[model samples]
Target: MMALQATLQHHPLLRATLRSGWRERWSFSGDMLPALRWREGETGGLLPQAEEIDLRREAGLKVYVVQDRSTVDVTFQFHHACCDGAGIDRFTDDLMVHYAGLREFGKSYKFVPTVDPNRLAVRGAYGLSFFRTLKRLPGQLVGLMGAAQFWGRQPIPLLAHQARDRCTKSTKAYPALTSFLLDPSQTLALRKAANHRNVTVHELLVCEFFCALWDWQKLYGQYSERHWTRMMIPINLRDASYRSLPALNYVSSIFLDRRGDQGGDRDQLLKGIRAEMEVIKRFQLRYTFLFVLNILNGMPWALKRSVQQDTCKTSVIFSSAGKTTRRCPLPRRDGFLHVADLVLRDIDGLAPLRPYNCVTMFTLEYANRLKLNLHYDAEFVSEKQSDVLMDLFVAGLNQVADTAGTQL
Candidate 1:
């Protein structure tokens, strides 16, 4: 507990609180760290759901520790306005390192605090000059127009039955989570399959997700040639220069729009995604989203009104948090990461759910194993439907792995 608290003191953003009014700002204080919440039991088993954090009155971060006999599970929940997935990973790495140092070296271990923690702010992180942003404005405008046209047509939700009307009446957002894991062998096969096709594992995963969604929706007779499947892929904007920055929101997204007819064939869909992703990377088109955000930042009323009237622009938000182990300072014992006496068995977290964008997919690779976490708004999607969708996704990946083995 001491190490954890000490670690939080080093990151300014962790202790900051959100202050809203005409203009919102983050207020930081030395004595504002949230007390750690600890529980005893098997966190993996069925249990009563915890209440959601109210960011307006509390800190933007929450830490919970669950200890069950010999196993310990730690979960961190952060408001999206304060941090991104990469930021969470970075913070976890620091926490483990702190705990390990305190346990091993005891009194001799001295902690080093982050220098100029205020620099972690998203300001100037996009690396876009005023002139450059102006140059990109036209292209971004065109893309927004294209997105508006698609949204005007009303893209179908992942589930066949719509619950937006019923869900809107509820004051609280009830987000539910479900997850599955691929063993090292299965993960290896998937990687090999990606290599055989000259595509990245990330690209392959996206393609498989699209295919799985198509198949799952077809079961409910939701498949239509006119319907479009829009997905938002978050792109981390942190380059080598911003690598040392603390956990914060330094991410943008690239939208992928595909018609039902376009995603019917797996190979063709993969080909199209690969080419589109290449173009997005080659031209650094991810900055286009950031440019629009910068413009909105200056107009507070416009941003507020947009959020209040926000509709689900995309079918799903998919984030691939690749290889978390690489950034960790702690050593692995047996097959799991160990911090002092605690063995880290698993790491799973949910992406935030929005009004219409109820379903979000988060993927993380740890200990050479790939884990997929599905988070959905309970008001929007039922628990049974979430399970079926996850099953289809896993089945799609297993099919790819099996095909790879046959080729071998």
Candidate 2:
């Protein structure tokens, strides 16, 4: 672990995020301190929050190793201000390569990864226009107001109210988190199901998620004949044409609108999801705001706050890191050390202070296993409630798998 720390401490990506301080932009100044340590437990909360490296003063990443009776787990905590999941992927890949060289080759390894600054602008939809910016301003303003109302007033949405009687009250936001993991075999089944339906795994997950929400509402709350829900799906900009850059915030989120009034049919649901996703993938939603974000790497906090506030109208934010085809080079077992799990915690930003008004789901494939990590405001979703939703979600996926070729 000591050797691992030494290696990561020098990584260019980690160092860039660490040494840079945030204001309006990242400025290089203080040296960063990225740590590595061991704990005793199979399952435990990551490093204590009280005494530790300060993100503003130190590095935005920290690593914790836990030793259980039969397995070892590695936990990575990252400040959202510095990096996103894609950034984490790059770091993980680098870490694995470095570790493999140290353990297998017995050499002090080092390498730096470079990022293309003009990547976003090269996407063909990034040219700037004063008239376009001016036109979007009013819409952005409306979005901000809508967010404030959704988060503060907690009023029923115009479309939602027409469907059924629902309760809207502000509750203390607590951290209620959960995970739903599919073993390798189950993950394979899910892929096969998606292929059968002629849709991507992400579309399948979204369909099931919406179905699960509908099921939950029918079982626990108001049952609407026709309910309108909103979710934000972030698109990764580092694909194909644009090289994967080691930069944070290189993502743009597109909002998805779902209206489920028809009788719950898995085929219909999956079909709708696939259609919407296709539209989203095509034209790239005009690559909205990509050019703007690229220009402002570390957007001013006030601007971020304004944008985030405007997005409170969404019921959830669902992001899928897709699949990692490149295998992790870090040895799973190297005499005395048996890597059991690689856990990624999503406590980015000052989560408790201004918690997400809606639940957030982050899905990814690691070590060939599909997994989901859910983050919800505890006041809105208790532990029991979260369990119910997750159980339904898993069941929904399996149901699709069971009917793969026969159904949609």
Candidate 3:
């Protein structure tokens, strides 16, 4: 346990080396704590996938929940400093294990491995973090151009692109789906294809994802100027900075704005991701502290806020290692939505080196069944539009699998 906790503390990716500006460590006292708790978990069984109440933080932070329901609702409090979406996921997974008697809690749940504490690689994402300058304009522009050129080319047709026509309006209502489950077999097959292609799974997946989107566009080029949903990929620090120490939210979301297929061909996109990834992988492991020294230089105050709002604009955010939503589902709550289970597993262990774009499915898990939660904006994507998206998502999944030669 000492080793695990220490490892948790020591890994650079696990630790939030970024200064929180506050002199004092965070305190989770008062109304800031959870407002409700259930003595018996919502699940009739030993473990549930997602707990109710939908308590989470911004940019997918992490929280610890304990049900001394007899006590006040304030028991489940979290320190925003170190916890992240992945971290929360890990906590929930372990909690469920402990709850289910599969894994003991506390003393029973102590295992630690050695880790290196460094953040330079992960820190480099903020290119402006270097040069002590305000605008990362140069790097951003270069990266943007490279990314842009990569995407400018079209590979897939449109009608099959599920992301199109769905986000004309934003959703803040209940989640549209229950859970995002991966067909481990399908994922494995895709990985193998990527390996055979000599490209990364992420590169191939991104390529395939874009191809699928393009295919949809070809069918119905709704607008004269083609614009699709901007995708976000979470870069995990495991391969680059540190090895598998369950760090909560040890990830960063990199935006890939495809204005009519900017990704270069099969060769270029893979190369760019690999090049960028390699730089990060090297910098984050040993000299992340140096990168930290440059942050204030890279991003000034106003710019930082803009970045936060644009990139981290999810209605709910969480991090878990595994077994997210394993806790039994809770009754519905006001002002809250369901869980978004994002599974980005390299089931085939292919292209661990190349970066992959994120594929997230937001859903509601009730009674051990996963349902997609679609929060729709009445104006643009009506219930009808939401339905279209649902159908398209199914279509997209199937098409992608078929394209990758898998039995959907």
Candidate 4:
């Protein structure tokens, strides 16, 4: 705990709070360390209580430590407006380094924070050239026209029949989470399968998610022509130059739009996804979303109005925190990462739920194993249905692995 406090004292963004009123800004606060919460019990059911961190009154980040017997689970909850998944990974790496040093050197250990002045400069991180971004405008405009399929028609919800309320009435939205793990051997099989298909692991994961969700919805009689299933995948903008930056939001996203009637075998789906991703990469289209956001940032009223009028532009968000163990500076003990006296067993990345987009999926690879976590609005998806969705996703990956074993 003392090590964490010492680390936070050096990180500016982690010890900052938002200013009130329409024009908001972050102000550094020295007392943020006291807000850390500690509890006793196994961490289960990722649901946020109403009394958790309030960004308006408190700092932008909150840390919770839950201990059960000899095991410890640390959960970090932060406002999405402040930081991204990669940012959290960076912070965790720093925290582990500090903890290990403190344990070995006691009070003699000194903490030095990473310094990057351009951390908050999003455009700088992307190295966005005016002429370069402008040249891709036409292609992006065409993509926007394609995204119109989701404008008029409502995107299919995960489990609409199980909604507890017609509309989410809580002042704060808390996502309920369920997770499953893939052993190292299974993880290797999936990677080999992706290699066999000539697609990246991320593209393969996206294909499986789409196919599994399609099959699950068809089983429930929710498949139709008019409804669309649009998924948003966030792209981290930080490159090698930004490696030393602290935790902050430096991310953009690409949207994949597919109609409900577009069902096919896994190979066909993977092919289509790979082609689209190729176009996105060739054109550097992820920056298009950031360009629009930059424009909207100037007009707070229009931004607020657009969000208020949002009609489920996205059905789900799929984010991957690739190879988390590579970013940490911790030693391994019995196949698990260790920090001081505690053995780090598992790490789950939980994506925040949006207003109309009730379901969010996250993938994190740690210690040669892959873990999939699903966070959904309980009001929109039932607990049983969430379990079924997870089963379908895992089954899809297992089938791919089984096929790879026979061919390769």
Tens digits of per-residue lDDT, candidate 1, 232-255, equal 899998777676778778788988
lDDT of candidate model 4 versus the reference: 0.75
What's model 1's overall lDDT? 0.75
Model 2 steric clash total: 0
TM-score per model over all chains = 0.89, 0.70, 0.47, 0.88
Candidate ranking (TM-score, best to worst): 1, 4, 2, 3
Stretches of candidate 2 off by over 4 Å are 1-23, 35-37, 42-55, 68-70, 107-175, 222-227, 241-244, 262-265, 289-305, 308-311, 325-358, 404-408
Ranking by lDDT: 1, 4, 2, 3
User: RMSD (Cα, Å) of candidate 3?
Assistant: 11.7
Candidate 3, superposed: residue stretches over 4 Å from native: 1-25, 28-36, 39-82, 100-172, 178-184, 211-230, 238-247, 261-300, 304-387, 390-405
* Alpha-carbon runs more than 4 Å astray in model 4: 42-52, 115-118, 121-125, 129-154, 161-174, 297-300, 406-408
Worst 10 residues of 2 by lDDT: 156-165
**lDDT value for model 2:** 0.56
Give the per-residue lDDT of model 4 (tens digit) for 21-50. 767778777776536678888765454452
Screening candidate 1 with a backbone cut-off below 3 angstroms (N, C-alpha, C), the clashing residue pairs are: none
What are the root-mean-square deviations of the candidates from the true structure over C-alphas? 3.1, 7.7, 11.7, 3.3
Question: Which stretches in model 1 have alpha-carbon errors above 4 Å?
Answer: 46-50, 113-116, 121-124, 129-153, 160-174, 297-300, 406-408
